[model samples]
Target: MIKTNYHTHTTRCKHAVGSDEAYVLAAIEAGLDEIGFSDHAPWPKHPLEEHFIRMHMDEYNDYVQSVLRLKRQYANKIKIRLGLEAEYFEDRMEVLKKFIDETPLDYVVFGNHFHQLEINGRYYGRYQKTNQLLEHYEHDSIAGLKTGYYKIFAHPDLFVRSINQWDEDVANMSRRIIQCAKEMGVVLEYNLGGIRNFSHVDLAYPYDPFWDLVAEIGADVVIGVDAHDPEDFLDFDSIARAEKILEQKGINVLERLAF
Candidate 1:
C-alpha cells in the first residue's frame, strides 16, 4: 500500500487551502506514514505580479520554520519532510539553487508549470496552448531533471492537458522524459490532483498513454496526492485509481523515496 505523500501544499500558496497542522492531522486520520509539505517555492527576485500562485518570498523562512516545528512535534507519530514544488525558470536557477542550499529541505519536486521565455514580457503556462508549446515544456522539464536537484518529477505528462490527444510527437516526448528519468535516477509522480480536479473530463495528464510509454521505459514511479487542501490529504479514491493504473501499465510504483 502507498503509505507516504510528498506533494502536499498549504494556504501560503494562495491557490491551496488549509493550515500546516490540518494537513498533518488529516494525513494521520487517513493512515499515512509520512507527509511532506511541498508548497510552491517563491521566486524572491521575480516580479510581484508573478507571485500569483506561490507564497511571497518574504514568507519563505516562516514556511520552513512552521514545517520544521511540526516535524519535531510529530516525530514519533509520522515522518514529515520539508520540500517545495518548484518550477524551472531557465534564467533563475541560480536563485533557486541558493534557496535549496540554504534551506533544510528533504527534497524538491519539479512541477514545470511555466515554459521558459516570455511572450509579451511574461512567461506562458503549459496549459495555455496545445502541441505548439509542448517542445518548450519538454525542453524546460528535461533541463530541470538534469539539474539533479529534484527528487521527483511531478505530473510528468502534464502536457496532455493542453494537447488533449496522443500522437507521434506526444509519444516521443513521453519516451524522452521516461528515458531521462531512468538515466538521472529520479522518480516520476502519478499526481492525484488532476484526478480530483478534472475527474469529470479527460485530463491532459495522468494520461494512460503516457504511462504506457513509461512501462516500456521501465522508469521508477511514485504516487502523490498533490494535496492543495486538507480534504485532499484523504483522497483515497484517487490514490486507488492511480494504483490501478500503475498496476495495469506494469509500472514500478514505489511507496517511498530512499533519500
Candidate 2:
C-alpha cells in the first residue's frame, strides 16, 4: 500500500542481511516508487554508549557509495534518497555536525537508543530492564527528540520497546513529546515495524503513543519498515495494520515515505 519507503539498512550495517541493489530491486518488485537508505551513523561507541548496533567505517562508506551509484543508475525508474539513522544526543550536536560534515547525506532521522539519554548522553537502541530504567531513558530521549531539525522521529513510541513504560508519568511524558513534535513541525513515524513484536516481549501497540499523538495534533505521519533485509521491503502488509490503527485515531493521510 506504500509507494515509497525511507528507512532500511544495507549490508553495510553488517547485522543487516541484504545487498544494496537487492533491497532496491525488491522495492521495485513490491511496486515501491521510492526508496531511501538510512544506515546507522558511525558513532564512537563507549561502554557508556550501549545499543550501538553499527558497522565498520569502510563498510559504511562503501555501502553509501554503492547505493548512491545504484540510485543514479536507476534514477529513471525510481527515486532514491541517502540518509542516516543518527542517534539523538543533544550534547553531541557538535559531534553530529562533524558527522554530517563527514558524510554526504540528504536527510537525517533521529532514533533514541541509548542508556543515559540526557541532552549530553548518547543513544544506541538497546532495551532497558525496569520501570526506573525506562523512565530514565525516556527522559533522555525526550530531550533528544525535541530537536527541530530532524525530518522525522523514527519511532515515536520508542519507550514501549527498550523500557516498556506505560504509567501515568510515562503517559504524561508521551503527551509532552507529542506536543513538542507538533510545535516543531517534526513528522511522527508510524513505525510500521511495531507489528513485528520484535522486542521478544508483549506490547499491545509498540508505537501507539506517537501515532495517537499524531492523530490528536493533526501532525504529519510517515511509515518506516525499519527493514534490515531484502524480504522486509514487502513490509507494507504490517504497516497496513499500523495504518488502520492510525486511521481509527483520525489521522487519515498516510504519506508515502522514501528514505
Stretches of candidate 1 above 4 Å error? 45-48, 117-131
lDDT of each: 0.84, 0.68
Candidate 1 per-residue lDDT over residues 143-203, each given as its tens digit:
9899999999998877776675678987888799789988998899998988887767675
Q: After superposition, how far is residue 229 of candidate 2 from its true place, in Å?
A: 1.0
Q: Put down candidate 2 lDDT per residue, 1-259, tens digits, no spaces.
A: 7787788887666578877888888889888888788887766555454433666544666867887898999999899988777766555566567656776777777766555342223332345345465565556556666654467777767656544445677667677777777677666776666566553555443556556666776777777878888888776668677667767888855566433
Q: Compute each candidate's TM-score over C-alphas.
A: 0.94, 0.84
Relative to the true structure, candidate 2 reaches a TM of 0.84
Worst 10 residues of 2 by lDDT: 116-125
State each candidate's clash count. 2, 12
